[model samples]
Target: MEFEMIIMNLLNYSGEARSYSMEAIQFAKDGEVEKAKKSIEEAEQKISLAHKFQTSLIHSEAQGEKLSISLLLIHAEDHLMNAITIKDMATEFVDLYVRMSKISNGGC
Candidate 1:
């Protein structure tokens, strides 16, 4: 694939992951645990796809390939990082919501 195409894929996957993570958080807030979990799973899948693209670039660079750095690449990287962070935080929020729900339901 062309470098620009790879970058665009990275951006697209990362953006989708971020959206799913946000949806997971919202679902958890709404007390829809299953839907929240499903969203988190979807986010993880997108993150995995994005990471594959990232790893391909890393492997290329390790083998003495020169990659031209561009603003779009930087933006894509930023989106991937933000998506990862949000996904992680969303997982924690989902767990917290589950616990709160249990507590409210007299589960201890």
Candidate 2:
């Protein structure tokens, strides 16, 4: 794939991951446990796709390939980072919600 296309894919996957993470949180808030779990799974898949593209770039650089550093590339990296952060936080939030539900229901 072309460099630009790779970067675009990174952006797309990251954005999708972020969106799914948000959906997970929303589902959890609505007490849809299964849907929340599914959303988190989807988010993870998207993050994995983004990480695959990122690994290719890292390997290329390790092999002495110097890629041009463009503003779009920087933006893409920022998006990926934010998506990862959101996914992490969303997982925590989902867990918290589940715990709260169990507590309210008097479950150990």
Candidate 3:
């Protein structure tokens, strides 16, 4: 795959993962545990795909291939990082919400 295409894929997947994380948080807030979990799962898959692309770039660079660092690539990296952070936070939030719900319902 072309470098630009790889960057674009990273951006697209990262953005999608971030969006799914946001959706998961909202669902958790709304007390939709199943939906929230599903969204988190989707986000994880996207993040995994993005990671694969990132690893490919890293491997190429390690093989002495000169990969030009572009502003777009930096932006994609930022998006990927943010997506990972948000996904992790969303998982915590989901767990918190579930715990709160169980506590409120007297289920311990």
Candidate 4:
């Protein structure tokens, strides 16, 4: 596969993951635990797809093959990192929302 194709896939997956993570946090803020869980699941799926692309490159490199680096490749990696950071932060924010909900319901 071409490097451009890989980078496009990475960007797509990262965008999907980031959107879902944001939705998950919004759901939590709205006091919808089930919906938040579903959104988080969707986010995880996207992240998994991104990981697949990353692993393919790593596997090829491990076989002494070269993966060309380009501007798009670097941008895709940047997007992936941002998505991952957002995902982690979203999880924490969701947890905090749950705690707040519990407290409001008098059982925190």
Candidate 3 TM-score, C-alpha based? 0.97
lDDT of 2 at 105: 98
Per-residue lDDT of candidate 2, residues 5-101 (tens digit): 9999999999999999999999999999889999999999999999999989999999999999999999999999999999999999999999999
Model 1: residues >4 Å from true position, as ranges? Answer: none
lDDT of 1 by residue, 9-106 (tens): 99999999999999999999999999999999999999999999999999999999999999999999999999999999999999999999999999
Which structure is stronger by lDDT: 2 or 3? 3
Alpha carbon lDDT at 12, candidate 3: 99
Clashing pairs in 4: none
Give me the displacement of residue 19 in model 4, in angstroms. 0.3
Output the better candidate (2/4) by lDDT.
Answer: 2
Model 2 CA RMSD to the hidden true structure, in angstroms: 0.8
Q: Note the clash tally of each candidate.
A: 0, 0, 0, 0
Ranking by lDDT: 3, 1, 2, 4
When 1 and 4 are scored with lDDT, the better candidate is 1
Worst lDDT 10-window in candidate 1: 1-10
Structure candidate 3, residue pairs in collision: none
Instruction: State the weakest 10-residue window (summed lDDT) of model 4.
Output: 1-10
Global lDDT of each model?
0.98, 0.95, 0.99, 0.90
The model with the greater TM-score, 3 or 4, is 3
lDDT of 4 at 56: 84
Give lDDT: candidate 2, residue 22: 100
